[model samples]
Target: MSGTSGSYNAVTWLLDRNVDEGRGAKLAFTDTVSELTYGDLQRQTRCVANMLRRLGVRREERVAMIMLDTTDFPSVFLGAIRAGIVPVPLNTLLTTDQYAYVLADSRARVLFVSEALYPVVKDIVGRMPDLEHVVVSGNDAFGHKKLSDELAGENESFATVPTHAEEPAFWLYSSGSTGMPKGVRHLHSNLQATAETYGEQVLGIKESDVCLSAAKLFFAYGLGNALTFPMSVGASTVLNAERPTPARMYELLNRYNPTIFYGAPTLFASMLNDAATKNERAGTGLRVCTSAGEALPESVGNAWKARFGVDILDGVGSTELLHIFLSNAPGDIKYGCSGRPVPGYKVRLVNEAGEEVPDGEVGELLVEAPSAAEGYWNQRSKTRQTFQGHWTYTGDKYTRDADGRYTFCGRADDMFKVSGIWVSPFEVESALITHPAVLQAAVVPEADSEGLLKPKAFVVLRPDCNTDGLYESLKEHVKQKIGPWKYPRWIDVVDSLPMTATGKIQRFKLRDGAS
Candidate 1:
């Protein structure tokens, strides 16, 4: 691996280089709906670059994508990067108002959208003063130029725009759990660094592997899972345009038989519950299964391995860090601990005073990696606060063992106090999910009648589970797993938990709705 200095464009390194290596004839991407070979992918991306260039898109100009997980999504994204245009992949599940805010903030000159999604943003596109063009795929219902039409007769030999290694290549919006989503700007070399360190060194991604991720291309995790890792190593990926329900996932697995499957804990829990209800094993040909975006409960891991005969390697990463820096490797997976930092990254558990803490003591995690984002796009104050010097201060809290494996201890804000004793919501939720009937659980501090804070759980029960007296049984189960003091004083069985677009539980919503 080379140092992060000198000129580099990720588009050239990931795509053009693979073509140069004579792997262009190999399959690159596939979904239930479509498939593209590496040669075809390169040609389509070059067409996208030509189309953008014909539309007067300039180097470093921001181009936003609001399309689903199709071959065109990666084509447009890499095409923008190849042409030195900053690609901003927006979440598909966000509200129209949120989309309007992101479009206004990014001041994107052009937006590439799908026909299905164009109607949602059509009324708002005219209101965006900086938006010069609306490029839609599949249909031209709004009189916008079709992406396919623009690509017709386009040459397949566009030269990738040369960019400095430090220049901004793309931007990803944060989950915005704390506030409005801030654009995290990543450099051209950042993708290569993560692919080399985590993808190559940790995941050992091979050209023969095929990947399918429940996390969409809009997220950093999904981008790495679906595009960066596979493209970097000349591997293939399966894309799904629709939401990855358990049923849909099973269908994809049976059809594609992906070597690697990436999903969040929420998805895993849903799959487990679904499998349990169906009373049949969901077969998959996965060589490895990964869990991230949130903590993976021990019980979920155990049950998944029992049902599917594959271990779920839980890890941790952030939008600012590009991809997973801490991961459980193939032969050394710890069911409950996030493994040591990747070879190219540095990790430290720091106290509130910003000093390193001793082993087994919970503290905020600070990570420094070559692939870390430069800073928030337009947030100077926040950039200074989060990305200080070389280290990026992740808001996640963790405790490291003597052997260096880090155990997640929930977010700094997610930890609350009960009777002057601090309680970690992740701990309580993990305990609750361990119960046989509970599929998913979220714990938040709810105020009692006397204004005292206590832990309250909102749980999703597996289908056909008896709810009568199950609440008391869960309380006792949690008490036995942890301790009496940490047990939820109140538990509410719910149909489902509030989740973010990327499948993380929105604990704040539960906290707000708690009586």
Candidate 2:
């Protein structure tokens, strides 16, 4: 929080500060395969920086990390920033073609890919003319320069870069409403800005806490949760490199006993529905849990608290704003709402005419925060539209109450009128999730027999649920819970909903296939 003025680097604030405070021997990170202490992290970070420099990756140049959650992640990520090199952490789950597109777009000079993921990017490596080296992390480097070889001769005594705080630090590719990835550039000051505002003010992250996040490091939410927030206060983090399934989550929870856990809404619902975990308490030492990526359904939130004895601090965040600017914190929480703006941020609900709407009306949400991204890379028009002078336009639709609580109303393009009134897909889905038989739900507008747009549902049911007379039962349940006009006219029972790699429901796909 102190040094963001002229010459500041995030490495000194997040990693080196802990070492200076005499937490050098304390565990900084414990991954599935290895653990790293603060002292080890500091030394490793410097070595990585020297390695990048030796590889001829110059200042302000790009390096891509297609890595899993591991102890090596922080060393590489912080090392790049410390030496004035930009590190782009990409989604490990992307296809080879997607990887090629992003690598070419960013023009990354070196790619540090994990050994397990080498197969995916192997064939595409030749197509990248700008990509100079393919350094593999694990053993069996697969005929490429290994990361250990690059760091072996390097000394752990590199000087930190005296880059301006407003200078670009890194880039995160965001697949906005169009589903195309564009590089979102963030400044050196943005990391600590989010840590101070949301991490310090809302979540109250501390040194004694141990953190676990089902959200991967590739995401903005995960970066703040597992990396910046915990490291900001000298806390420890547990990183899981494998899939975060229900059983796997419980295994980690029982083993590490993380005090703060971060996950998406769908994961929470599935965990609650998993037969073995139905009556289970939360992690023995869990003080709090967080839900993001999508709005938390009321039924899921209330049920989780009842069973686990902790609250799910459901909040709204994006790749553009970096982390949760609007959130439901510990005390002033309501299940279905995205609480309020964090202490250092501001939000507004604007109508189509760009005028701020009054409370109780739906409008597009815009946020004013210190951590907002500079703009999209190579997207001047979009950057102008999204990052307006002082406010960043969020593509979400929300309604505010008199007390400043914001309730999600689907996406701006997803809302449609039923009976000449706006219908929030989230509202209908929340109602559907309250029913005993329904495990998950997605609602989209479909043409009725009369050719009018009406609510239609796709639901994933509980394993023990009987399907006989189920559609009618669900219909009546939703009608009684919300209102008659808001109930779904048709229901399609399905095994799973279509989801993006980021865990968001691909409603546009459902709308395209609507009856």
Candidate 3:
């Protein structure tokens, strides 16, 4: 049997492992007004687990949660795990139809929703025949039991259900940037492996540190930042129940004074563009900042450092990998490049023939990590194609340096051919955004009059910029920065580019002429 074969419940190992070791009194999670000590978290999780079991939630039964940055999210998530139920966290920003699709696909029996989000899915709840109950936070007016009311009567002493470490613990649906989202199935030991490797070795998360993430708890990046990493180290996390706008983020940083901050490149760029960000940065107490979900443009990174005096450690991970497998560590960052693989994970850049590519040549990224999900839920074809034995194939393309650092070269599907030559959209987009007038940029191949495809750029210019001569100016800037052939043949200045919930530009939508 493997090391992960024994009966090992993750919630038990994470929650009850250290409650008697002097960490019980420490702050585990907090919002603006409410907080939960480690002791309080342990008890609340137990209560939630007991309530779910009484509701007839059996082992491996799915319990879905549509929650924001509140304490209820983590409490219910851990509680589901304690009773051996699989917890599925859905994206809060998704449409009601999208939520209905996931609930139906996952066959979830019980759903926990926040009061703010319940209204979005209330109409569709009747359409989902598989869902038996709806549990809501803040208020019970939405034809469901109040989460607080249910936890009030239950005692906080349920026994942790025993299960193998490889057993299913949770499921996170992939951000449906391509098409329909696929459910990624993670195991009991996956969270702990990432916490020990990435949390301990890469980020050096400590008990004294207070963490804040603009990324919400639903996405994988935010899940690690706000829940897994902080809880594993007994650190406190500042929760933001509201949407993370520039103003809200600035207020949280000034109010909470967190030591570590996590955000995607879009969020960082928004803060850099906001003039009011300067007023709130006087005493943020920030020591480390992390960026993920998309490649952090070098220009954006440089501007953030110049204004904030903090380096954004850019990294790359996916829904299948659970957390960051490759990352830039503190004091060891290279601008615009995803750094070396974190400890305990092996990364390979392989050609289409499954052979390792030479240095400086682009190839598909293949990762082998213990924290990786078992496979996509109910996706046998995708599982066989992506996960071969211990190696999981990442669809993104990259090139490696002699120093073992990885540089992202866009997704395999994002690479397009132009005039019989291959072009990387990310490379061209990076060059386009360097122009003074360009705020954000995305490149895609558009057909010319001759029916041959050429690079076309969709750009969002800086506020109050002259749009009269901007199109030609951006084209010339790209030509000067990169080669003429790589320059965008047609440039369209737009108000804004389409984005995913995780802050990544949805290029597929742009390619379809939807933007």
Candidate number with greatest lDDT? 2
The RMSD (Cα, Å) of candidate 1 is 1.7
Q: What TM-score does model 2 achieve against the real structure?
A: 0.98
TM-score, every prediction: 0.96, 0.98, 0.97
Q: Candidate 1: deviation at residue 405, Å?
A: 1.5
The residue ranges of model 2 lying beyond 4 angstroms of the native Cα positions read: 279-281
How would you encode candidate 3's per-residue C-alpha lDDT over 1-515 as one tens digit per residue? Answer: 13375789887767776587789988989988789888999999999989998998899999999987888888999999998999999999888888988999999999999898888999988779899889998866476899999999898889889888989999999996776789999999998998998888989998888999988888888999998998887889999999899999888888889999999988888888876665558236888899999999999889888888988889998889988999999878897899999999998888879999999888999999989898888889999999999999989999889888898878888877776766888889999888877788999888888987888899888887777777777788888887788888888878899999888888888889922
Q: All candidates' lDDT scores?
A: 0.87, 0.91, 0.87
Error (Å) of candidate 2 at residue 497 is 0.5
Error of 2 at 445 (Å): 1.1
lDDT of 1 by residue, 1-515 (tens): 44247668778788888989999899899866678888888899888888889889899889999989998898899999888999999988777888898999998999999889987897899999889998887756479878888788888889878788889999998987856789999988889998989899888899999999999999999999999999998999999998889888887887888989999988887787775345544545688888899988888888888878888889999999989989888888888788889889999889889999999888899998988898998899999989989899998989899988998988888887888877889999999888878878899998889998889999888778777789789999999998998999898878888888877888888877885
Report the poorest 10 consecutive residues by lDDT, candidate 3.
275-284
